[model samples]
Target: MKLNSDYWEDRYQNNEIGWNVGKITTPIKNYIDQLKDKTIRILIPGAGNGYEFEYLIHKGFKNVFVVDFASTPLENIKIRIPNLDKNQLILSDFFELEGKYDLIIEQTFFCAIKPNLRENYVHKMNSLLNPKGKLAGLLFQFPLSENGPPFGGSIQEYKKLFEADFKIKYLEIAYNSIKSRKDNELFFIFLLK
Candidate 1:
């Protein structure tokens, strides 16, 4: 019931990660493609296997970082991305992490946490970012219900949750989601307010 580090670690250890897309998702890929500054510091929290982290490195973004409390997935990412900077592959709980970044990439992480921590998550995200820094990625688009790690949510709910700390730059149905998530995801870009 509690989606803590142990819960996520077990999912990776047992190979039960349905959310591991194996590669960067389309919406995230597209968003990265348009970024003009390779120097911007980027953080990818709850990054399982970290395809996006590798992609950013390959694209010449030197300050990209990935944080996850689970060792298995972080190890997998290190193995897969052989050239990854040791400092960039952080092994720590997302909420407990420190340092400011220009951007944060969200994927399945938002849904993995218990709903009660939503406000804390938002506050932590705001704290991790530099002034005017952005948070961008996909959010599952559906009704919020009790049953899930991949908990679903509506745009209205997302707006209410993030509006207090971020300027919602873009939040809409992601046109580039992978086939399985086509109509079920929202691509969002929010700047620290």
Candidate 2:
């Protein structure tokens, strides 16, 4: 119930990361494919296994970073990308991380946090980005409940939570999500306000 670093480290040690899709999901891949800038600083917080980090680096993106409280996934990424800068593979609490990024990619990170901290998550994300920077990616679209690290959320809730700090560019059911997540994922692009 703590959901602390120990909890996450145990999950990795036990190989219980269901939120890890093993590869970058389609919605995110498509979004990345469209991005023309390869020099923008990007951060992926709570990046278990860091599939997106791998993809970004493979696509020639520089200045990409990933942070996870658990060391296992960060080590995995290091092994997977042996040449990746050590500094870019941040093994620390996401909330404690400091930097300005052109973009922050959200995957299952939001859902993994306790719901009560949702407001703080928004503020932290807002503070992390530079002016006009973006926070984009998929959010699971299901009812909130007590039974998960994969906790669900809806567009209305998201809008109310993020609108104060971001310009909602797009928020809708992701048409290209992997089969398991089809219709259950909302892809969004929120630019800093």
Candidate 3:
């Protein structure tokens, strides 16, 4: 139940990452495609396998970065994108990480952590973003229960959780989620308040 570095590393070694989609999900990819700036600093916390990281780089995004405590996925990224800057692939706890970014891309990291850490995750995300920066991506939408690393949440819950620190620009069921996640995901964009 301790979702620490070793736990994640073991998941990778065992190929137990059920949350990984093996490729960037459509909602996130569409979001990135609409972005006109390629130089903005971006961070992808809990970047398991880094499909999004690779997608951004391949699309000419220069300041993209990824942070994951597990060395396995970070190493996987290095092997997949041989020319990627090593410093941009940080192998460290997301909470302990420092530096301001214009954007932080969230996928499944929020659910992977214990539910008790949800508030801390929001604060940490707010701290890592520069003024007016955004935290954008998909969040799973389902009844919150005791069974998951792929924990589920509702739109109303998310609104209360982020509205204090972020201007919730968008939060609704994702219209273009991958088939597997169709009605189960919510695409959101929250700008720093």
Candidate 4:
């Protein structure tokens, strides 16, 4: 239950990653489609199999990077993106990663970590962004409990956790989420405070 590299690597090794939806979810995909700049330095933390990274690169984004503590998914990304730059695939703890990004893509990463680390995740994400940078993507909406890596959260909880540090540009139930996640995901856009 440490949720460390070994924990995650084992999940990948055992094919137990339930968080991966097999493709970029519609909310995120629609967000990416509206992005006008392809040069932005982007980071996707806990990016299992990196469908977002793959989508970005294929769409001509040049500075996309994905970090996961597990080696298996990073290798998976490398194989899928045969021309990928080595520097773009980072295998390290998300909190230990150092970089300034214009945008940070959050997927199931927040839910995977122990809830106690939520504040630390916020701090690290803020530090890793360039001035006025955005932290965007889905957050699960449900009751919180001790039973999961896909931990659930509610809108009130998320606001109390993030509002002091980020401008809540948008926080609402996602209208375009994939069917399985419909009504259970909040699509958000938070800019640095």
How close is every model to the real structure, measured as TM-score? 0.97, 0.98, 0.98, 0.98
C-alpha local distance difference test of each model:
0.91, 0.93, 0.93, 0.93
**Cα lDDT over the full model 1:** 0.91
Residues 10-67 of candidate 1: C-alpha lDDT, one tens digit per residue? 9898999898878988889889999999999999998989988888988989999999
Q: What is the Cα-based lDDT of residue 74 in candidate 2?
A: 92
Where is model 1 poorest over a 10-residue stretch in terms of lDDT?
Answer: 77-86
Candidate 1 global Cα RMSD: 0.9
The TM-score obtained by model 2 is: 0.98
Clashes of each: 0, 0, 0, 0
Candidate number with the higher lDDT (1 or 4): 4
Q: Where in model 4 is the C-alpha error above 4 Å?
A: none
> In model 3, which range of ten residues has the least summed lDDT?
144-153
Lowest lDDT 10-mer window, candidate 2? Answer: 17-26
